[model samples]
Target: MALQIFNVLGREKQLFQPIEPGFVRMYVCGLTVYDYAHIGHAKNYIAFDVVVKYLRHSGYNVLYVQNITDVGHLRDDGTDPIIKKALRAQSAPMQIVEMYARSFFEDMDALGVIRPDISPRASAHIPEQIKMIQTLIRKGHAYEVNGSVYFDVTTDPDYGKLSNRRIDAQQAGSREEIRGEKRNPEDFALWKNAEPEHILRWDSPWGEGFPGWHIECSAMAKKYLGDTFDIHGGGIDNMFPHNESEIAQSECANDADYARFWMHVGSLTVDGMKMGKSLGNFVTIKDALKRYRPEVIRMFVQSAHYSSPIDYSDDAVQGVARGHERMMNAVRLTRRALATAPQTDDGNAILAAVEKARADFTAAMDDDFNTPLATAALQELTREVNALLNSGTTVGASVLKAIAETYDQLGGAVLGIIPATDDSAAGNASREAGLIELLIKLRSEARAAKNWKESDRLRDELAALGVILEDRADGTVWKVN
Candidate 1:
């Protein structure tokens, strides 16, 4: 089957088609860079990361752009979160931006998320934002009042098309305050007049001000990915005013459609409650890495559809971790059997299983990226291969090689839950195995020398790292859990 995506624009599963054949242009709204990234951020980015990887694997040249909002992301009370964080820490706004921007990328890298092709910062793209606002004002889609610009929601009759809300149904001044400067309560700011105490300010035709939260995205997406792109994505929480305003203003200013497909990841909750710092349940990416491997985290996220809400808890992630280990063990055992197996005369049963797993994985992915089902296909293959390997028959080298390749392609490349057993990775594995053997030898020597305290310490430490040492009558053997 061909690829299909649940485009939020139409609220249906549509066949995947890019604006240009053999190429895809995509943009996702990035973080505001005021603090460290959390698990919720990990879920959102990992969803898009897999999308980009799958698109490229399907033979499309993809150019992905994500923006960084360093300024002008205002609260409902007209305060910038960056400035608020900076003041609380007694530092400059740019200092806070620089620190957390690095922190955000570090966390994403640890989670195995691929970086975007272009990361345009809002502060660096002021000229482009100013030009777009000027175009809106000249086209009568916006108005300047008291050195500030507001997008006239009434001017664009299709104002709430994306959110499917009528202008009258929306609470006026719900985001921004009701003021005499706005013609209507639902009108949002295109550019805000910076107060004298504002840390981040720029000179514009309207005065010294900054771009609004919504305009920054519209301007940056237009500049990097063109006026219209193939896909635009972000968290579903931003679908209402942030994404809705982006569509209305971009179409009005450029006289073209904004994005062909809109993809939104569902919100992530912690143990059936919203994750928050005040709630004492916030899981930062850094803190999560302390307890779980990056691959484990990726597997937990892929256990659910990208468009479906997921709950994060220790029990949930621990289950995924065990599943990930099962798959990895299958690959490890297959490679070990391949080392001494005969070259020819193999039955086609294992090879057929490999082919069936590949087809099943692709089919699941094609049906709107149904990752849970795709992973189930992998687990099924793992079970079959494990049974074959443990049976009293010698699997041929060619059959084992085929099984390994399928895991590399489907699990490593597509879902990113399994690491490729390439030369480099194999070398690392060999080194780790050597270290464990050496520790076991030292512990054996200590036991032979009747040093009970030191021997017990070494054995306990290795067990802490999931390496169990069994003392048999023949010798000592070790296994990783």
Candidate 2:
């Protein structure tokens, strides 16, 4: 099956046909960099990360760009300029940008989100943004007012095509308390004039100010991916004002479609409420990582479909931990079985199973990147491998090796789980020695007291830890192998 992706712009699952054959250009809106990253951020990025991984696995060259919104992100809840709010709060814009950008990257790295090919910051691309805004003004799609530029949404008949809202309807929806300078209520700013106290002011044709929130994306995306690109993605909340304005300004400026496929991941909720800092139920990624394993957190995020809301909670994370442990145990057993099998030249059955699993995984992914289903397929394969290993049939080493390779490719390379095993056993040896010494000391104490129960318990515990103890003719001996 051809790869199908749910294009939010068209509101349909369309077969992905890259503009350049065999190459894909994708962009995702990054964090605003005003606070530490949260599980919502993790869910969005990891979902896209898997999409990128699977696309490459299926033989597509993807140039993925995710922009970091370090500036031009407003602070106030309503339509007032965010920079004005920042100035009133007496916080330097760059200071806020630097502090939060660092926190965002740290949290993302902890969550194992592969850094985008190009992470353009809005502040760094101000010139590009200004240029685009100028082109929009020249094209009569934008106008300057009081040293600020605002996109004239009234000029673009298809302004709300992506969000499927009529311009009149949007104007009616936004009728109350409209800004007097805007030609229409639906019009959005391309540039905001800086007050004397605005710390992020820059020299622009309009005035000394920063680019607007939506303009940075249009500018940077066009700069890197051309006037048109394969994909543009962000949270669903950006659909109306942010992305819609982007479409109007960009298409009007360049006289071309901005992006072919628009993808928006759903929100993350906590206890049935949307997870936001203002909502007071937000949990930062750093705080969650301190409690849960990073892999468990990732698994929790991936448990749901990208276009659906993922509810965050302690119970949910614990459930993910349980599932992760099961997969890890399966991998461990597969490795041991492979190590003990006899050598052989050929193993067709194992090879066939591996091929089938790969094919099934790809098929599921191609169908709109159905990760939840793809993950289920992987779990089923792991179950089959474990069952085969425990059947007590004599399997050849070649077959076992094939099973190991499949597990590594799917689990490590694709899913980003299961760290690569190193050839040196120094770490394992040290751990084994420490465990053995502790177990022997406990067993001797149990024997001294003639406590059979305690002695058996100690032996069982060691066995659970992958250690085996045997009573020899001379004395008790332990062998790691």
Candidate 3:
């Protein structure tokens, strides 16, 4: 099935057709490395990560590039964000960038957000940015003002195509004097003049200046993924002005579409307001990782569609944690069944149900990478497997292997909700599984022998070890907490 994506360009869902057959080139706007990444950032990257994962799973060779803005991103007062962080920390701006950039990688790794193939930092691509700015100027779409360059939005006929905002409505001297250096108020900066005190400034054709926020992404994306790419994605907040400026500079300079698909993930809120550090309601990715497992957090992010707002709280993550554990327990039970059952006939109701679920999972993923629906299919498979396990009917080894492999393919390989079954994680998991089974057997024997106090004590002991036990009529079920 051809994947369908909601392209923000036309505000409609369209079937995804890459520029090159059998390959996808994707670029996701990355973060400014001034501070630690937050939960809002987590949702943004994970959304694109799943997109890339599913695309690869569907047999496309994907080249994913996510740029890091260590310089040029400015505050409202026209100061570099990294410079501001440097001032606060009593260190150099690059030091702050290095510190947080390392933390960003660590935090995203913890969240299971896959690293991009090319992590092109803006500071590293200074020459490429300068060249793009020069091209915009040579093409008569930009002008210089006192060692700074600005992209003249009026030069482009379809300036507001990506964002619905009109670029033809600016009247000279009719607006506030916010952008005094710009020819038009809507004209975005391509390069900014840096003061002598600024430490991150580089020598450009204009003078000792730095790349603007919008121009960095334009240059980096073109450098790594070429003028036209399959997908360009970021948070919806980047739709206006930021991404809009990128569209103008890239297409005007390269004379081609900037990106075929403009995908934007929804914002994350807290309580009822946007999550921000100044708002004091924001949760850092560091803090959230301390409490929840990475897979639990992935499940929480995948619970809703990518383009939907997520209201985050402890309650939200905890709810998803329970759901994630249930899914993992189902995988464990299927693995157990596979390990012990005899190799015989596979014709059974359970086998048919598992095959149908595998098909459903693929169908759900192909439809705009609908992770919630895909996860639902897996959960249904779990339910079917649990019923078969408790039906008092012997499930053959072939049937159990099919069920386990199906779960591993869709659950672990595609969605990444399940951990990898290779390496030390698998070894440690096996050890834990054996210990958990022993405890379950001891507790079950205590219950059958009418030793109520002994069973309760054993359950309490397991609880202290973070193992949750559910005693069904047929047997005991256990999952790691």
How far residue 106's Cα lies from its native spot in candidate 1, in Å, is 0.7
**Which stretches in model 1 have alpha-carbon errors above 4 Å?**
169-179, 345-347, 421-432, 438-461, 469-481
Q: Model 2: C-alpha RMSD to truth?
A: 4.7
Query: How much is the lDDT of residue 140 in candidate 1?
Result: 97
Off by over 4 Å in 2: 77-92, 169-176, 345-352, 421-481
Which residue window of length 10 is worst by lDDT in model 1? Answer: 420-429
List model 3 lDDT by residue over 1-481, tens digit each. 7689989999998999999998999999999998889988999999998998888888899999999999888888878888988999899888998999999999988877889999999999999999998999999999999999998888998888998988556474356675587888888889988888777889988889888999999999999999999999999999988999999999999999999999999898877689877889978899888898878888888899899989888898899988887777777766756666788854376777887898888888778778899999989988888777766677788887888788777887677788755221223457667777887898889998999999999999889987777776657866655
| Candidate lDDT values, in order | 0.88, 0.78, 0.86
Which pairs of residues collide in candidate 1? none
Candidate of highest lDDT: 1
Worst 10 residues of 2 by lDDT: 419-428
What tens-digit string does per-residue lDDT give for candidate 1 at 195-283? Answer: 99898999999899999989999999998889999999999999989999999899999999999999999989999999998999999
Better of 1 and 2 by TM-score: 1
Q: Tell me the tens digit of each residue's lDDT in model 2 across 351-468.
A: 6667777888788888887777777777777777767655656678787777777767766666666545522112345665666867777897888899989999988888897666
- Candidate order, lDDT descending: 1, 3, 2
